[model samples]
Target: MKFLKVGRVAIITRGRYAGKKCELGEGLKTNSETEVLTEELQVVIIQPQDNGNKSHPYPHALVAGIERYPSQITRRMSKAKQTKRSKVKPFIKVINYNHLMPTRYTLELEGLKSVITAETFKEVSQREEAKKTIKKTLEERYTSGKNRWFFTPLRF
Candidate 1:
């Protein structure tokens, strides 16, 4: 059974979020029917390539939805403006362990675990709120000048 700590950053290797980056947030039982429980875990996608869910083709949606850093945030910007300018679009998913390629980075944000979860994706309002949480945390992290590599877009 895999038992990885929450908050480890990883890249999705399959499915709609493939090639995108995310942070491990919760550990879930891979199965409960036959397994002893304690296998796979869930993640919070911080830098997604496209519509991580739904039937839409990943390539088509990825053209404009990819982002891994904080956009310019000026003091003059209003709350609504800031929210609109944010490029972060986080998704919470309880995916299989094999699909995630763990990285050396780990990012722990306040209220992240509470706001982001597999259920957060069930409703549009919840997803939007979670996105806002992710954006705020990321902006804070970026401005604080820590976890530089985690926030940088992958090259090549």
Candidate 2:
């Protein structure tokens, strides 16, 4: 199986980070059954930065200047019963690869000065703009008036 490389830009399609983009970090090896069972298959790390949105809760906020998420976690069988526990502190969020959307964008971590060049910035900006326009058009077309309802209203 092909593994995700570091520096890849992926969107969190599941947990708290859902709809947010992040850069991949280092890979981790599993040495025990618990690790395999928890489906802590891979680690994805992200560093918080200023998003310029005041309402954003995680604006440049992180527990240790970084966050790590495992590739997957099994569902709970019982709401009150805790199944797996971690000795290491839990991350700010967690998600699986099934919920991650790999993007065409890739982050360059070669050096601080060369991290984001003008060309790369322009490409990213254009992609984001296109996404916004598509989302706006779709919402306007499909979410207007009575289309929001999944079923017809019942007449008493």
Candidate 3:
């Protein structure tokens, strides 16, 4: 099996986030400002849970991706509304390595490093707030025509 590095884009093939595309891991930023580095996080292999879940024996890597696809721009809506509707809804989840179908696309979202911290997933309110920031970042990237295919909803 291939190792999943940070910034690797993948599709979630199982559970609630099934079919949604996600990028693997947040960036690596050391506390020392003088020695700034944004490298891929380490991939650690952990022991399988005792739950006897055959489908996903040993899970590795945590990824964050859009939970809901952006809404279509309707002519009936105002410009402000249209702008709001364009944002991507995001979600952070610890998924099974097998459940993710890796793609050739890899999106290195610079804002995600600051927005998605370990504490972002600690509470509902914090998570929701972080999602809003992530939504804005994704929207900017999408509108800029960078990684257009990666941003679009996957078709059957």
Best by lDDT: 3
lDDT (0 to 1) per candidate = 0.51, 0.31, 0.59
Q: After superposition, how far is residue 55 of candidate 2 from its true place, in Å?
A: 35
lDDT of 2 by residue, 1-156 (tens): 033345555555444434444444332211111121112111223332233123322222111001222122236544333222111122222233454555565544332222222222245574345334423332343334222221111122
Candidate 3's C-alpha runs over 4 A off are 26-58, 74-78
TM-score computed on alpha carbons, candidate 2: 0.30
Shift in Å, residue 56, candidate 1: 21
Every model's Cα RMSD, please? 10.9, 18.6, 10.9
- C-alpha TM-scores of all predictions: 0.59, 0.30, 0.68
Ranking of models by lDDT: 3, 1, 2
Residue pairs in clash, model 2: 71-96
Backbone atom clashes (below 3 Å) for every candidate: 0, 1, 0
Q: Is candidate 1 or candidate 3 better by lDDT?
A: 3
Q: Which residue pairs collide, candidate 1?
A: none
Question: In angstroms, how far off is 3's CA in candidate 2?
Answer: 6.1
Cα lDDT tens digits, model 3, 15-109, are: 66667778876322111111222221211111112222343345444566766666778799999998787777666656666666777766777
Local error of candidate 1 at residue 29 (angstroms): 8.8
